[model samples]
Each structure stands twice: as C-alpha cells, then as structure tokens.
Target: MARIAIIFLTFVCVFGGATFVKSIEEDFIRLPLTSLHSRSRRKADVVDPNAKKVNLWNDRNLQYGINITVGTPPQPFILHLDTGSADVWVPSVNGDCPYLCKAVNKYDSSKSSTYKEIPGKTFTLGYETGGLSGSVAEETISFAGLEIKNQVIGIGENQDTDLNSYPLDGIIGFPWSGATSQTDPKSTILGNLHKNGHIKKRFACLKLHQVNEQPGGELLLGGCDVEAEHWGRVYGNGYWEIPIDKVEAFGTDGNSLDSICGPGSSVPDCRATFDTGAAVIGGPSYLIDPIASKLGASKYDENINDYIVDCDDQTLGNLEFTFGKFKVVMTPGDYLSKDGNTCTLGFARLDDLSALLLGDPFLRKVTLLMNQEKDEAGLAKSNIDKPVARPT
Candidate 1:
C-alpha cells in the first residue's frame, strides 16, 4: 500500500502533561482485534457505549482486520484496517469477479434497503502489492457499536489475484481524505465520522500484539492511550514518515558491525514510513545489502528478491533504529522469520522509493499513535507483557 497520513482539523492537547478535554460523553472507542492464525482463550465483553469496543482479526501477522456491517439489516464482512490508504471497499456480488471474490463474503446491494448507487462514479485504488477498481455507492455502515449512515464505499468490480491469498472480505482505509476516490471529503468514512461528531479527536492508536499471542491487539479511535509512553514528533509530507538519526547493527559478541547510516557513514539523513498493511520492511538495495551482508546473509535469490539465511543461527544480534533521541531495538527473533529450516530477512529491497518502509516487523514493538489534526505521529513501546483482554 502507498504510505499516506490521516488528515483532519481539531484542537491539540498535551497528552502526558496537561488535562485532556473530553469532547463527548462517549469520547473514545477501544476496539479489540483477533489474529486469524491464533485462537484465544478469552471471552467477549459487553459493549459499553461509553467505552465502545469492536472485534478485529489479524491474518498471520501480515494484516489486521475488523468486522463491520453494511445496509439497513446489516450484512457483515471482515475488512482489513489499512493505515496506508483511504477509502472503504468491499467485494460486490454484482461485480464481474468470480474466482477470488467467491472465497470471501460479498456485498449484495439488492438485499440492502439503505443502499444507494452512485451512477457513473468509479473507485480505483493502487498499492505496492496489488490494486482494485470498482463502482461507488453509499450505505449505512456499522462497526463496534458505532453507526455511520450514508457512508460512501466502493463495491469492487475488479480485483488483483495477489489479494486472494489473504483471508479478508474488504478493506477499511484510514488515511487522509485526499487519498480517497471521493471528491467530497465528507463522503469518506473517517471524514463522515468527524463531520457527524462521532469522533472528537482526529487521531488513532494501534497496538499490535506479538505473533505468538492468542488474541491480537487494540485500535483506539479518537484518542491515545494515556498509559503508553510517548516518543518523538512525526515529520513528513502526505505520509506517516519520520526522521531516523541512525541505524546500527551488532553481532552476538556485542561488537558493532560497519555503520549503515548516520554520522561517519557514506549515507545520512534517513527517513522511514510506518505502514500497517505491509508485513516486512523495505528500503533501497544500497542500504539493505550492507546490513544483509553483515548478518552473513550473502546468498540473494534473484527470483524471490530476498536474501536467504539460516533459521538456526543462534549467534545473531540486535538491530537498533534511532529516531531522534529514542531508540527501538529489534532482536533476531523480531527481524527474521523462520519457515521450516529456511529463514529470510524481513527487510526487502525497494529501490523505487527514497525512504524506507517500516512495516509490521518494526510496528509490532510499538504502540503507534497518529494525530491527523497536527499532521504528526508518535510511538511507544507496546505493553504486550500484560495483554488487555478486550472484547473479541
């Protein structure tokens, strides 16, 4: 998915220092999410309007999704909560697609009393992985006890084969209004929520659980978790991009590898985008090649475009990413994924984009908070040691 920022306009308040102003009696929604690959031993909680919660699901640590209903009577579907793009879309039963669309649920407008077709209006979205094109329509969409009436959404007419690998019915984009296909900002789901006074603050917080955890994590809409530690300010144009002060690697003996970037290195001024939709990190080959070599991953597969490494290597060390004064360290367990005996480096080569794409591998360690109103983002170490048993 193309990295983009969520845009909005609202008053800013100091989180850790000052008192927070509650815009509404029911100010925030703490939605619980599930992972498709894991089963939970927890039970569901009652839905409290004051603390509205919804069920979300994760697909093999690659994607996280939520359950939502559309139309009057409410037809349910599992939609991916994508932060990299904007626009809500579902597979349409009326669409020409048959093979992949049949694998999951499809939106049937004819059965929906509140469905309103927007003639001649088409929705098209593209991402680094795949793309989709469809027709535009409006319907009453509900999720996590919150109802959005007449919310514009896409009914997929065509889809890429690559998307079929995931266990999802559709996508719920969380980027800015400018990224949506709709010309009117109010037509987008988040935009409509803001205009309708459903969400007081124009911000969202994501806490992704560890891969081994039973249930997934929580996604907070309209506010940040006060308990989580806050990091540096976000800086970029239209994406959730941040500046990197340095990237350092170490061996099992704690000896530093050759400097990748920052002071006294060939390259300086590194930047990265936080993307929830991406499963792995991606950067220029020039930057990744050195890190891969230092880790003893010298064999690069031309067809797969990734370096193959030994999964049983117990001598690997940590990878540190310094942003401003804050540092995030990833152990070998966090950066390398093992499938049987073969293991591949989580970081990939993306020569097309200048900045690195920091995906789930990096995000899993932090609770990312994005403020659309301020065009800023923040991060905090995830409190995964004490997982919250949310409604799922």
Candidate 2:
C-alpha cells in the first residue's frame, strides 16, 4: 500500500437521476457500481463540460474521508455521504469500475500492510452511477486526531464488479466527509469506535458545494471551529437518520416561500440520510416540487431533478429545518453561492417530491453531525463550531 498520510475525510459525488430533486421519488440503484461503466446513465448524472464546476468530476461523492491505520499502513479514501443509498465501500485491486475509477498506480505495500479480514461478512455499496462491493474485514481507520480500529471494512471482488483497470484502492462511503477520503471504511471505523466505547462520541460533519454551481467551499468533521475537550465535544454525525422538521422555499422575504405544512407532522416523512455520496439534496414527491408549485415558486424541468437556475434573484430565500433544539435557518445566499460565471445558483426538485433528501446545497449551510451508534445527529449552524468561508 502506498504511504498515505493520516486519514482525512473529504467528499465528492453528484446528484443524478430524478430522485435527486427534493421530494421526488424515482428508482435509484442503491448498490455501488459493479464497475465505473455503470455511470448511472440518467438525466441528472451527466455534467456539462462547459458548465460552472469546470472540474467534470466535481460531484460530492468524490470528496470524503480521512486517513486510517490498517496495521501500520496508511490508507486514504473519500466517502460518498449519500442519503439516497446505503452500504460502504473501498478501492480494491479487482476490476470493472471504469466510469468512476481513478488509478493510483501501484500501492507500495512494503512499509506495513496491517489489515484483518472478517471471514464471512460481505459488504455491497451501489448507486445509479457505480459501486464498490467487497467482503467485510477489520482494520484500523484513523482521522486527523482520532482513530478507530477492528471495524468491518469492504474488500471488492475482482470477478464480481468492474473496477476500472486503475480504480481508487480507497473507499466509497455514506457517512459525512469533512476528514479525508483516503481512508477505508471511514464511517464504520468512526461508528465502531463510538459503539465499542473506544471513544465517548464520534462525529461526521460536511460542507458541500451545490450540484450546479462551482467555486464554493468545504465541510468539516470533529467540530472544526469548536474546540473539543475530550474529542467528544467535537460534534459530528458519523451516521444519522433525521426527520424533516420543516421545508420551506423562501421568497425574497427570507421566509417560507412555499407552504409545505399540511403534511400532519412539521417535517417530511422519510429516513433523511446525511450522505456524502449525493451532490444535490433529494426527497420524495408531495414534499418537494408539489409544495413549490403550491407556493408559486420557480422550478425548472431541465429534464432532470437537479437543475441550474439563472438565479440572479440572489436570495434563494430561507429554508429552515429543525433537529432537536436546533432550528437551522438556510438562507438563499447559501445556495446562491457565488460560483463560476453562472447566471444563477443551482437548485432542483425531485420528480416525486414526497420524501425529503438534503444534499450538499443544504449541508453546506448547516452543521450536520452523525451518530451511527445512536442513529442520531447534532444539527448546528454550519458556522456553529466552524468558520464559514465565503466563495471567492
């Protein structure tokens, strides 16, 4: 294994297909790509090479992870941080992943390859794009200041998936990536540590860029701006499942632009995932566009759920979501992130708009913490414990 620095948590994944739009429900492949070739051929997945995020691979799935010590070898990788899908993944020496594989050449495993296999547990992760399938093994995964060991990790099988001839020998994750994307099984590592008492608490926080805009900034894990006393003070959600307390499209008034309220509960109905895999926020029908139409908000039929707006309106308005005691207020400027030469910030609606899915656009505005052990999270101001960097 090539020498990787301390595991960092970062992320990169795009919003593809119709389901990516909030409140929209579409058939999305929940499994990791058997290979890169299965590029989730759909409406939202493809990028306009000439668009704002000049980097064609500027999706959120690609920017997750930190470093981890498997025995003594330093392994690095990114997490998908997807709420739309499930399972975890890592880059393996197998084959089949053409579309999303990035070759790191030969991993000089001469230093010390310290990884333990978990015998019979098989792990599979997929998407409309591709996936990483492998067996569950135990290894030591570490971040900047913390470490988790003996957690179940994924190992791809060559014959089973199409891992591009030179794919990343890293990870595909669902946990938030504010650390490093070069670590293997980062979410499991963090969750295992918290569950096994290795750590009092663990967190996974993220800062994401919009699906359509570019020139935005990052996400943080382990309470970046907020200093932790025993590390637990670092608020992060390595894993989480939250209820949508509220979803309102703000008009120029910075208030709820749309009235999505009649839904019995104040929030949306669905297992909201704090994922690094998806780029745009996603949701089921009756929750996203329908509500938008109800409020007379502007929507686009880019022929895809994830759409770009010529939004010179500046104020995408305020969309608030409450979790526990925290009531997060999302401003239009957050989504109106000053990126590229675009006529406006990017925004989209899912075809189904029933179940709500929060993506990078919303994540970057608030601090999303994950607690896999408790299936809970700490939602704070994106600038709560961290400094919010303005788009340059």
Residue by residue across 220-250, what tens digits does model 1's lDDT show? 6665443223334455344567677798777
RMSD after CA superposition, every candidate = 11.3, 14.9
Give candidate 1 misplaced runs (Cα > 4 Å). Answer: 3-55, 180-189, 227-236, 385-392
lDDT of 1 at 132: 66
Highest lDDT, which number? 1
After TM-score superposition, the amount by which residue 241's alpha carbon in candidate 1 deviates from its true location, in angstroms, is: 1.4
Candidate 2: 10-residue stretch with minimal lDDT: 1-10
TM-score of each: 0.79, 0.57
How far in Å is the alpha carbon of 32 misplaced in model 1?
Answer: 21
Residue 350 C-alpha lDDT in model 2: 43
Worst 10 residues of 1 by lDDT: 5-14
Clashes of each: 2, 114
Error of 1 at 115 (Å): 2.1
